[model samples]
Structures are given as C-alpha cells and as structure tokens.
Target: MTSAQICIMIAIIVYLIGMIYIGFRCSKKNNSTDDFYLGGRKLGPFVTAMSAEASDMSSWLLMGLPGVAYLTGISDAGWTAIGLAAGTYINWLIVAKRIRRYTHTCNNSITIPSFFSNRYRDEKKMLQVIAAIFIVIFFIPYTASGFAACGKLFSSLFGVKYLTAMIISAIVIVAYTTLGGFLAASTTDFIQSIIMSVALIVVLIFGVETAGGIGAVIHNASELPGYLSMTLSYDVNTGKAAPYSALTIVSTAAWGLGYFGMPHILLRFMAIEDEKKLKLSRRVATIWVVISLFVAVFIGVIGYTMSKVGALEMLTGSNSETIIVKISALLSQHGVIFALLAGVILAGILASTMSTSDSQLLAASSAVSSDILGAFRKDSSNKNGSMAAARITLLVISVVAAFIARNPDSSVFAIVSFAWAGFGAAFGPVVLFSLFWKRTNKWGALAGMVCGGSMVFIWKYLIRPLGGIWNIYELLPAFLIACAAIVIVSLLTPKPSKEIEEEFDRVAQMK
Candidate 1:
C-alpha cells in the first residue's frame, strides 16, 4: 500500500481502539436508564458544551459546508457560516436554560417525545406517538447522511466499495453506542472535538500560509467572476450573474434557525445538570462552533485557491471524501509534520461523523421506547420493560440507518440540511410556543408538527412534481405555515384546562 494508505489505516485502527475502550469504560457507569441516556445528567459545562456542539456540527461542517464554499465561493461561505453562528448562539442563550429547567420540573424527561407528552399533558398518547413518529421519520434521512459521510471517507482511504465501507461504518457506530450508550458517546465526542479543533486550525493556518496569505486569496478571488460577489454565483447556463439581494443573504443566514428543533441537539439541554451552568455552556459551545466553522471555511477557501493555482482538485472527483486527502497531499510536500497533521484531519472526520450519528441513534431509540412504547404500557411497572425496549430500538435504528447509508442519494451534507430543516420547522415552533405560551394545546402541537413536517416532505417530493413554485426555501414556507397552524388551531380549539395552564407556568418558573 502507498504511504498515505498506510497512514490512514493506522489512524483508523488507533481511533477505533480509543473509541471502543472509551465505550467499555462508560458502560461501567450505566446503572440506570437515565445514566445510559443522559450520562447521569451530571456533566459539567465544558463537556456538555463540546459534546452538544460535536453532535450538532457532525460531518456537515467538514464536508458539505466546506465543499459548498469550495465549489461555490467565499460569499456563500460567509452568509451560511454567519447565519449558523448567530442562530446557534441565540438557541444556546434562549432555549438552553428554559428547557433544562422545565424538563426537570416536567418529571425529568429523558427524551424529546417525553417532553411533549408531559408538556401538553398528552394523556391520550397523541403527542407522544406523533413526536416519536417524526423523530423516526426525519431522523432516518439524517442518520443516513452521517453514514454516507463515513462511507465516503472509508472508500477514499481503503479503495473499498461504498456498500462495504458503509457496513464497516455502521459496525463501528453500533459497537461503541450499543455497548457504551451516552457516556461512551460523550467521552469520545469530547476527545474528538479537541482533535477536530486542532486539525482544522492547523490546516487553516498552513493552507493560508502556503497560499501566500488572505490578502493574496482575496485578491485572486476578486479577479474571478462571482468569486468575491456575496450575492450569488453566476449561472453558467444563464450566462448572467444572479442578482444578489438581501433576501438571498437572509435566507442563507437562516440556516442556523434549524438549531432549536433538532432532537439530537436539544437533548443536550435536558442532559445538563442545572440551569446555572448554562451560561458557561453557552460560551464554550459558541466558541467551539465559531472556531470549527471558521477553520472549515478557511480550508475550503484555501483548497479552491490551490486549485486555481493549478493544483489538482481535491474537493471533487470519484473520491470526494478525500478532500482532506488532497489537502494532505499538498501539505505533505513540506515534511513529516504535515503528514501527522493529515492523520489528525482523518481522525477529526471520523470523530465528527461518529459523534453525530451516535446521538441520532440515541434520540430515535429514546423516542420509540420511552414515548411510543410507554404510551401503550401505561402501568408504571413497565419502566424496566420500557428501557429494555429502548435498547432494542437502538439496535433496529442503527441497522436500518446503516442499510440506508448503502444507497445515499446525495452528499451527507445535503441530506443533513433537509433533515435539519424538517426538524426545525416541525419542532422549533412547537417547542417555543409550548414553553412560553399557555394556549398551546395538544391539538396545536399536533397541527404544527404535521403541517411543518408534511410541508417539508411535500416540498421535497410533491412540489417538484408539479411545476416548481418559487425559488423560496421549503423551510421558510413550512415554518410559516406551522406557526400559522399552531396559532389558528390553538385559538380554535378549547383552551387548555386552567390546571394545565398553571402547571405550565410552574414548570416555566423553575430554577
């Protein structure tokens, strides 16, 4: 095998060993369902923040976002990155403390579905079933995206078929997650977050230096059509630059709006110990996100500049997963240190994908076992049975997601965005209204979720079948419709019982 191949194989083996050992260590702490699902809710701010960010960012930060920046331009990078940063920061600030406090008061919800069932007093199993279904439905495509990323990485490194690579990826995820649960996943995410930060920063610095600096990059970019334009990339087919507008930039920036509703992400708030730590968690998580995103964008910019300078294209080709491989090849011309940096980059990619995928599995499992199954076995005696069902649910989800990964329709980054938008539109409005508004009844929550989620799927599948509507994003339409549905439905339905309204107020008032 080539030296690069050897390095990649060695790196993968070492990373896997570390992850497995960590999983075994974490399993020792798994004495109860809470411990398994939430790491005992004793996590400090640093671990909580980093773990949440790691789970949220995933391979999209390394692959899709960067690839878009590279293939498109710096303008696309700036808008999307800035938008995500702002949205995430607001989510951490606005939702973190409130959710953490309310989940505890609402009987220490272990999952998002549990939160809904309790919040709306969904005694009829309505919210519970709906929430669980949406979690499963939207999460399948989301989990598939992460698996696709791992598959792409494996094929690039090992010259293996995508199916074989996908199976291998699934095995690694299941092995660590099925054995260790959240503790194992969180520990590895913490370690991986550090690896990702260091590797990307090193690359950003080295790439810019090699490319002659930011001034040179901007100057080179300026001379190219639509390269420096923040509006939109020129459509070669139309042969005209699309008019740049504020609406375009705002829509791109709104990518961050999806943060509030992502099931895998909000579970972090529920896992943290108390509301007091939220301040520190927010600071740490925001810093990690900003730094990591900046590094990824920098790599894309530098990668494109290198290609413009007659370097081979790294972000494209049959082995697109090896975009970092291309960067490594370029840097290795310098010496052994650069070679080691390449190893770090590979580890970062693995870490990001694993962290994200494991959390998704956890969310799906919890939703089914605790919400859907628990709804049927209403007797309190079934708690153990419910938890056992959760474990079984995890296995099924992992297998199904792995299977789907074998036949990904698009890049991991693209699939993830669709999932993110679905979750955001469907759940974000519901959660926000439930917490802050007293009038949000079970019907309103159900309507909001159905309308938002259905609209997303319609835009994805149906809207395209008819002549395409407008250029507006699907999430924008779905989100607006969901908000309207919630307000209209809640007003139309009987007001929630006065007792339920008081209970919501009490939960909202918790420390």
Candidate 2:
C-alpha cells in the first residue's frame, strides 16, 4: 500500500482508540438513566457547548455541504452558509434558554417529545406517539447520512466495501453509545469536536498554501462561468435542470433552523447545570460552529481548486465522495508529515460522523422511552423500566440506522437535507409557537405537528415527481403552512387552560 494509504489507516486507528478511551472513562458515570441520558444534568459550559455543536454539525458539515461547494463552486455556497448560519444563530438565541427553563419546569422532562407532551398535558400520549414516529422516520435519513460518510471514507481509504464500511462504523458507534449512553456520547463528542476543529484548521492552512495560496485558487475558480457569481445557473451534467439560483443557497443554509427542534441538540441545554450557564454555553457553542464551519467550507474550496488544476481527479476505482480523501492523499505525497495530516483530515470526517451519529441514536432512544412509553404510564416508579426501555431503544434504532445506511438508493446530500427539512418543518414552527404564543392550545400544536410533518413527507417524496412549478424545498412551505395552521387553529380553539397557563408562567419565571 502507498504511504498515503498507510497514513489514513493509522489515522482511523488513532480515532478509534481515542473514542474507546473516552467511552471507557465515561462508562462509570453511566450508572443511571439521568447520568446516561442527560449527563446527570450537570455538564460544564465547554463540554455542553462543544458536544452540542459537534453533534449538530455531523458528517454533513464535513462531507455533504463541502462536497456541494466543491462540485458547484462558491455561488451555491452563499445561500447555504447564510441560511444555515441564520437558523443556527436564531435557534441558539431563541430556543436555548426557553427550552432549558421550560423542560425543567415540566417535570424536568429528559427528551424532546416528552417536553411537548408535558407542556401540553391534554395531548400527552398523542404527542409522544407522533414524536416517536417522526423521530424514527426523520432520524433514519440523518443517521444514514452519517453512515454514508463512514462508508465513503472507509471505501476511499481502506478499499473496504461500502456496506462493510457502513457496518463497521455502525458497530463502533453502537458499542460506545450502548455502553455509555448520552454521557458517553456527549463526552466523546467534546473530544471529537476538538479533533475535528484542529484538523480542519490544519488542513485549511496547508491546502491553501499548497494550492498556490488563496489568490491563485480564487483566480482559477473564477475562470469557470459564474463561479464568482452570487447566483448559480448551471444544471447537472444531464441537462435535466437549471442551475441553482441565489435563493437556492439561502434555502439550503436556512438548514440551521432545524436545530431548534432537533432532540439531540436541545437536550444539551436542558442538561446544563443551571440557566445561568446557558449564556456561557451559547457563546462557546456559537464560536465553535463559526470556526468549524469556516474551516469545513475552506476545505471544500481548496479541494475544488486542487481538483480543477490537475492535482486530483476520479481514479480507476474511485468516485466523488473520495475526492476529499484523494486530495488528502495528494497532500501526503508532498511530505510524510503532510500524509499524516491527511489522516487527521480523514479522522475529522470520522469525528464529525461519530459525534453526530451517537447523539442521534441516543435521541431516538430517548424519544422512544422518555417520550413515548413514559407518557402513557402515570407511575413515576417506572424509572428503571424507562432506563431499560431507553437502552433497548438505542439498540433497535442503531440497527435500523445501520440497515438503512447500507441501502444503495439514497444520495448522501439529499438524504441528509431531506431529514433536516423534515425536522425543521415538523417541529420548528410548533416549538417556536408553543414557547412564545399564549393561545397555542393542544389541538393547535397537534395540528401544527401533523400538517408540518405531512407537508414535508408529501412535498419531498410525492409532489416533487409530479413536477410543475414547484421548486421550493419542502421545509420552507411546510414551515410556513405549519405556522399558519398554529395561528389559525389556535384562534379558532379555546386558549390554554388556567393550569397550563400557570405551568407556562412557572417555566418562564425560572430565570
């Protein structure tokens, strides 16, 4: 094997070792459901912030979005970066503190769906059921996206079959998650986040320097038609579509909105020791996001430049997803240290995938246990049962995620983006209205959930094929319609009862 190939293999081994070490360390803390799932609700500001951001960014941050920028150029990137940034910022500012306070008031609910069920007491079971369904459905695509990254990375580096890579990634993730639960997941996420951030920065610096610096890279890129344009007008090579416009970029970036309702991410805020720590968490999380995203985007830009200038291309047995790996290999050819650095880049991708995938599996399990099962039972004596349920749920969800990730049909970017829109559309509006609106009744909230979620499923899968004037992404339309349904239905229905009002007020009063 080539030295570059050897470097990648070593990097993968180092990452796996680090993950195992962290998992072992956190295993002692996994003594209870709270410790396992919410880190005993006592995580410090840095761990809380970094773990949340790392989980939120996922493989898509490293692979999918950057891949798009590499293939499509900077024009398409503007919308994605802007929209995603806006959504993430607003989610942090709006929902972070409120959900932190509200979840604590509502019996200190440990899961996203549970928070909803507890918030709107009248629809406890229904909310939990719908939530579980949505979690399982949307989560598959998200989890699959992460798995796809693993598949691509392993296939590129080790000549493993894609399916085998998927399974390997799945097993490693499930091992840590089942053994350590959320504490394991979050603690490792913090470590993985550091690795990812450092790797990105290092790769970005070297990649730009090696590619004749930023000026030459931009100049070469600008030679492509509309490469520097804010709007895109190119279609896929098949000639079946138009180039994405500037609006497409915005819509793509608005992806950050999905964070508001993401179960795994919001759980971080709830688990912080107190509301006061939220300020620190927010600052730390945002900075991590900004720096990491900047580096990821830069990596893609550099990759595209190197590819265009004859530094890399499709090999006899390789493909697009392997481009980053190949580019790293090319860097390795420059020096043994550069080859080692390439391994770091590969590990960065692994870190992003594992961090996000572990959190997703845990969140899915939490929904099944704390939200779905716990809602139907009134006896608080079932804590042990709930914990057992969560563990089982983790296993089941991981298996399902691994299975779907092995499927041959889905595209990496599309699957991830679809699930993201599903989460944003289905829960973003409902969560926002529930927190801020006084008149948001159970029925209205339920309506919002059904309409928003159904709209995404329909538009994304059903309506796209029938194809007429519909070019808008499902999230935009679903979010708008769901918000409208909440407002209109809430106005028609009775306001929240006095007790519910008191609960809301009590949550609000918790600093």
Candidate 3:
C-alpha cells in the first residue's frame, strides 16, 4: 500500500480500537438484560439526541443519500430529505416525549415489541411475538445494509475481498454490541454522530475547493439536462429529462413516515433519563438532521463536479453510493495530513454503519431474547440467564445479517429503502395510535402490524412493478394501509380495558 493508504488505515484502526475499548469499559455496568437492553433508563439529553439520529441515519445518510443525488440528480434525494427533516421534527415534537413517558409508565418496557405488548395489555403475548418477528424480518436487511456499506467502503478503497471486509466490520460491530449492549451502542453512536458531522464538513470543503468551488459546482450541475431540477431527472441512458411527477415526489418524501416506527430510534426516547429534556434533545436532533441531510445531498452535487474536474473518477450504478469514499480517497493523495483526514472521513463511513448496526443489533437481540424467548420462559424471574441469552441472540442475529449482506453487489440504498418501508408500515401507525389513541386495543395493534408488514412486500413485489404511476414507493401506500387498519380495527373491536385506559390518561398527564 502507498504511504497515504497506510496513514488512512492507521487512523481507522485507532478509531476502531477506541470503540472496542468503550464497549469493554461499558460492559462492567451491564449487570442484567435490563441494563444491557435499556441502559437502566439513564441516557442524558445529548447522548439520547445524537445517538438516535446517528443510528437512524446509518450509512444511508453518508452513502445512500449522496449516491441518489450523484446518480439521479436532486429530485429524489431532496424531497426525501425534506420529508425526513419534517418527519424528524414532527416525530420529536409529538412522539418522543409520549413514548418515553408511556414506556416508563407501562411497566418500564425496554423494547418496542415489549412496549406494544405491554402498552395494550396483551394477555397472550401475541402482539410481542408478532412484533418481534417483524423486527427480525425488517432489521436483518436493515442491519445488512450497514454491513454491506462497510464492505463496499473497504473493498472499493483498498483491494481486500469484499466478503472479508464485510465480516470484519460485522465482527467489530457484534463485538462491541454483544459486550456492552445499549450503553455501548448509544455512547458509540453519540461519538459517531460527531465523527459523521466532521466527515461531512471536511469532505464538503475539500471537495468544493477541488471541484472549483460552489459556483462551479452549481454551474456544472446545471449543464446536464434536468440535473438541478426537482421536477425532472437526467436519464443517463437516454440523455434526456424524465418527468418527476408530483405523485413520485410525495411518495419519495413519505420516508418521514418510517421514523415513527423505527425501533432503535424509539428506544432512545424510552431510555432517556428525563422526558422534559426531550425538548432539548428534539431541538438538537432536528437542527443536526436538517444540516446533515443538506450537506449529504449537496456532497453528491460536489462529487459530480469533482468527477468533471478529474478530482474523482466518475461513478455509476451502485458504485455511485461510494461518492463520499471516493472523495476521501482522493483527499488522501494530497499528503500525510490529508491522508489522515481521509482516514477520518473513511472512519465516518464506518461510524455511520457501526452506529446504526450496533443499535440495530441491540434492538433485534431484545426482540428475540427479551420479547420472544423471555416472554415464553417459565421462570421469567430469573434475571441471571437473561444477559447471556441476549448476548447469544445478538451474536446469532449479527451472523445472519453478515451472511445476508455477503453479496457485494447489493445496493445499500435499495436495502435501506425496503427495510425502512417495512418498519414504517408495520410499526409506524401502530406506535402512533398506541401512544396517542387510548381507545386502541390489542387487536387493532396486531391487525395494523400484520397488514402493514404484509402490504410492503405485496406492494413492492406485486403492485409497484407494474410500471408507470404504480412505481410509487411502497412505504406511502403501506403506511396508509396500516393506519387505516389500525383505526378501522380499533373501532370495530372492544375498547381497551379500564386499567389500560387509565394508564394512558396518566401518562398523558405526565409533565
């Protein structure tokens, strides 16, 4: 390897070592699954805010969003960002404090599945079982996208086997997460969010200068047909402007809907030390998300310009997702300092994946060990074995995710989009109604989960493939279906029990 490559590798190694050290350090505090899964509800505002957003963004923010812009222009990426920014704010504004309060109020439920089961007073535990099932279903692909992103980063930048790099990334993530669980994941996410921010800023500045600055970036972008237009996309194959319909814009923007159901992100709300502090967390998270999304999208524009100026190689298809990595790789060629900065940039890519992966692993682990197995255990009072069971489940899930992500050709954006739709459709409506609608019963939540989860597959594979307007994103229709199911099912079924109703009213009154 060149000196530049060596320097970048060293910087990444140091960052990885530090992350592992944190896991080991935090492991001392995890005495039981409660601590492991929920950090004993001890997260402060800053950690809670940053960790939630960091995990939520994953590699999609750094790689996927920029890639969308790099390949298709601003229409898809911009609208999605707009949708996500609004979703982030609205979710924080309304849902965060409520769920935080409700989770604590309803038997201190630690996981989303558990919260649903606990929230509705599901006596047979069917809600928890089904919810956990969906978590595993959607989260496997979701987590795999993170692993796939890491593999792409390493293999594209260096000459290592994609599978090898993927495994190493998965192992490191599993190591830290299995060792320390929630605290380790959250702490690392908070740190990773900072790294992600720094990486974005560094790349933006260096990439812009390398590409001949902001004016040049805009000018070059404008030269391509529909490249800078929100209502059109430059079709590289046809070399013509393709109409970006209003319906398509709305469908793409519906990404915001997924925020309501994101298990890992919701857990942050539940784990916070104080509900009142969530207002502060909301502000921080919103501002950060808005700024991050803008920069991430614009980086693609900068990347396009950079390619034109010979600072970066032109990328196509899934390789477009590596735009940030390409920029960082180019940065490394400038010298030792630049190489180290490139390392930091590269680590940011890892951080984006790791931050999300660790949180997801924890969430999925809880879904199995705590929500599924723990519920079925005859001796539920035995806390001693729970942590071991949780860790084992965590390892199994990580391995499954790694295996599924073994395909180096897998598109990070495609995986994330599908998984995001799954979670949003399946859990989004259920979560909102459960928290906000006290009249919502277990039957309604169950129906909503099943309907939403099923519709995503049906729509994506069956309906959306029909071409024309049917090509709309599955999340919008699935989310709507799920919401309708919840409302219609809730009204058709018997109302919640008095005790459950009182609990909702009580939580609603919480300061």
Candidate 4:
C-alpha cells in the first residue's frame, strides 16, 4: 500500500483500538442489568449531552445531509437542520428533566418500555411487550442504515468489498456495545462527538479553500438555479429552479417531532447523574449541534462548488453520498500528514456510524432482554442471566441489521427517515402525555401508541402516495392523530387511580 493509504489505515486502527479499550475498561462495571442498560444513572453532564447528540445525529449528518445539499441544494437540507435544532432544544427543555424525575419516581424504570409499563402500573405487561416489539421492528432498519454507511465509507476509501467492510464494522460495534453496555457506549460516544465536530469544521475549512474560497463558492452555487434558496430546489430536467411549497417546508421541519420518542436519546436523559446538570448539558449540546450542523451543510455547498469548477467530479444518486469521502480523499493529495488527518475525518464517519449503531443495538437489546424477556421470568434477581441475555440479543440484532444492510444500495437518509418517523409518531405522543397529562391512563397510552404507529404506515403508503396536501411528512399527521387518540380515549375511560394521580402530581412538582 502507498504511504498515504498506510497513514489513513493506521489512524483508523488507532481510533478503533481506543474504542475497544474503553469497552474493556467499562466491562467491570456491568455487574447488574441496571448498570448494563442505563449505566447505573451515573453519567456526567457533558458525557450525557455529547453522547446523546452524537448518537442522535449518526452518519446522516456527514453523508446524507451533505449528499442532499450536493444534489438538491439548500432547501431540503437547511430546513431539515432547522427542524432538528429546534427539536433538540425543545426536547431538552421540556422532556429531559420531567422524564428523568419520572423514571426515577416510577420504580426507577431503566428502559423506555419498562418506564411506560411502570408509569401506568400495567399489570398485564401489554405496554412493555408492544413497546419492545416496536423497538425491534424499527431499530433493525435504523441500525442497518449505520452499517450501510460503514460499507460505503470503507468501500470508497480502502477499496474493500462492501459486505466485508460492513461485516467488519458490525463486528466492532457489537464488540464494544456487548462488552461495556450503556457506560461504554456513552463514553465512546462522547469522544466520537468531538471527532465528528472537528472533522466537520476541518473538512469544511479545507473544502472551501479547495473550492477557491467562500466568495467563489457562493458565486458558483448562485449560478445553479435555486441552489441557495430555502423555498425552492433545482430541477435538473428543466434546468430551472422549482418552487418548494410551504407544505414541504413544514413537512421537512416536522423531523423535530421525532426527538420526543427516540428511545436512545431518552435513555441519556434518564441516565444523567443529576437533573440540575441537564441545564449545562443542554447548552453544551445545542452549541455543538448548531456549529456542527452549519459546517456539515456548508461542506455540501462546498462540494457542489468544487464539482461545478471542475475541481471534483460530480456524483449522482446514492453515489452522491460519497461527496464528503471524496473531499477527504482529495486532502490526501497534499501530503502524508494531511492524509493522516483525512483518515481521522474518515474515522469521524465511522465514529458517527458506530456511536449511533451501538446505542441502537444496546437499546434494542435492552428492550428484548430487560423489558420483554425479563418480564417473563419470575425471578428478577438474575443479574448475570439478564446481562447474558442482553449480550445475546445484541449479537442477534446486529446480525439481522447487517443482513439487511447487505443490499449495498440503500439510501442512508431514506432508511433513517422511515425509522425516525416510526419512533416519533408511535412513541412521541405517548411519552409526552405520560409525563405531562395526569389523566392519561394505560388505555389511552396503548391507544396512542397503536394509532400513532399505525398511522405512519397508513399515511406513508396509502395517503402520501396520493400527493397534493397529503404529501406532507407522515410524522406530523401521525403525531397529531396519536395525541388526539390519547386525549379522547383518556376522557372516555375512567380516571386513573388516585395513587397514580398523586404520583403524577409529585413528579410534576419535582425539582
């Protein structure tokens, strides 16, 4: 291999080794199911904040968002980023503290499903089963998207086969997650978050210089129809800017709604060592998110400028997702040291993928082992058994996700979006109601989950295809429907028991 290739490989290998070492270090802490699943509620503010956002952003931040800007221009990606930033802030402000206190109040529930089950005191365990089932169903595809991104990254960079690269990525993620569980995942995620932010800023700065500076980049993009407009997109066929309707903008912004229901993110809120520290966490997370997102979007704009000026070849379709990788590869042409830095940036892609996948895998495993299987076992003190079950489930789910990722042609953005909608619509309304609405009974919670989850499929497949007004994203409509179902159903049913009402009031008043 060339010196440049060797440098890149060594850098990546070092990053991977560091992650494995963290897993080993944290493995000793996994003495109980609580420790494995929720890190025993001991994460500090910065780790909680950075790890949550890192897992939330995933490879889509680097690959998918840039690809959209590279292909369609600023409208789609910019609005989506705005929506996510709003969601992140809102979720931290409203949901973080309440959920943290409520989970502790409600039998110290560790997983989302268990929290729901404990919150409503569901004797039948129906809520737990349903929530677990939904997690597995949605998270498989979500995890697969990360694996698919790894395949794309390795194949484009190292000339490795897609399947082989994907398998390697999957194995490493499974190793760390299975070994250290929540603590390991969160710690590694914090490190990855830093890497991701640095990579975005560094690549953007260099990419702009390579594209002949900011003025030239803007001028080149301005030449493309609707390339800079938030209310329009470029129509390649007609070679003109096409109007981006208000409905589309609203639909795209609805992505924020998904933050409410994401299991992995919610777990971070629950795991934070102190609720007061969340304020600090929120500020740190938001600042990082804003900076990182701005740089990521600009990287795409820079890629377009580079392509337009013949500095880089234009890519289309799924291949367009490689624009960031292409830009990083170009940095290698400068020198060995630059090539090594490029490898670190490339490792940032892996960092994004692994950080998210490990969280997803861990969440899915907890849903299965802690929520589903543990509910069935009469003996609840089998900590070792539960830990084993969790590891086994992680392995099984990772294998399934890898198999799904073997398609080699999946769009990372599309796949992540569908699963995002599923979690958002299905659980978002239910989670909000459970925390804030004192009258929200088990019946209402169950109804909300069922309605919200079902509506996503119905709207996406049946109604969305009809176009026109129905073209709005499924998450918004489904979210509304789910909220309505919960309120209407709760009013129709008997009021929650006095004990449940008192608990809600206590949590509401919690500091």
Give lDDT tens digits, candidate 3, residues 191-226: 999999999999999989999989999999998899
Per-residue lDDT tens digits for candidate 4, residues 296-323, read 8888899999998888998887677778
For residue 371, what is the lDDT in candidate 1?
74
Tens digits of per-residue lDDT for model 2, 1-511: 8877787688778888778777777877766677778888888888888998899887777666566666555655556666666666777788888988887778777777777778888553787778778988888668877887787778767777889888888888888888788888988999888878867777677778767899978887676665555665333353222466555654566666677677788888888886687788888877777766666666666876776667667222114445556666777787677788888888888998889999988877877776677667687576667667778888888787777778644576677678878888888888898888867988888898889889988888877677554666778778888899989998998888899998777767765
Residue pairs in candidate 1 whose N, alpha carbon or C atoms collide under 3 angstroms: none
The reply for model 1, stretches above 4 Å from the true place, is 234-240, 314-322, 333-335, 379-384, 408-410, 464-469
Worst 10 residues of 4 by lDDT: 315-324
Candidate 1 residue 479 Cα shift, in angstroms, is 1.1
Which residue pairs of candidate 3 clash? none
Q: Candidate 2's C-alpha lDDT? A: 0.77
How many pairs of residues collide in each model? 0, 8, 0, 0
Highest TM-score scorer? 4
User: All candidates' TM-scores?
Assistant: 0.94, 0.93, 0.98, 0.99
Clashing pairs in 2: 79-249, 79-250, 80-249, 80-253, 83-253, 83-254, 84-253, 234-243
lDDT of each: 0.78, 0.77, 0.91, 0.92
Poorest 10 consecutive residues of model 2 by lDDT? Answer: 233-242
Off by over 4 Å in 3: none
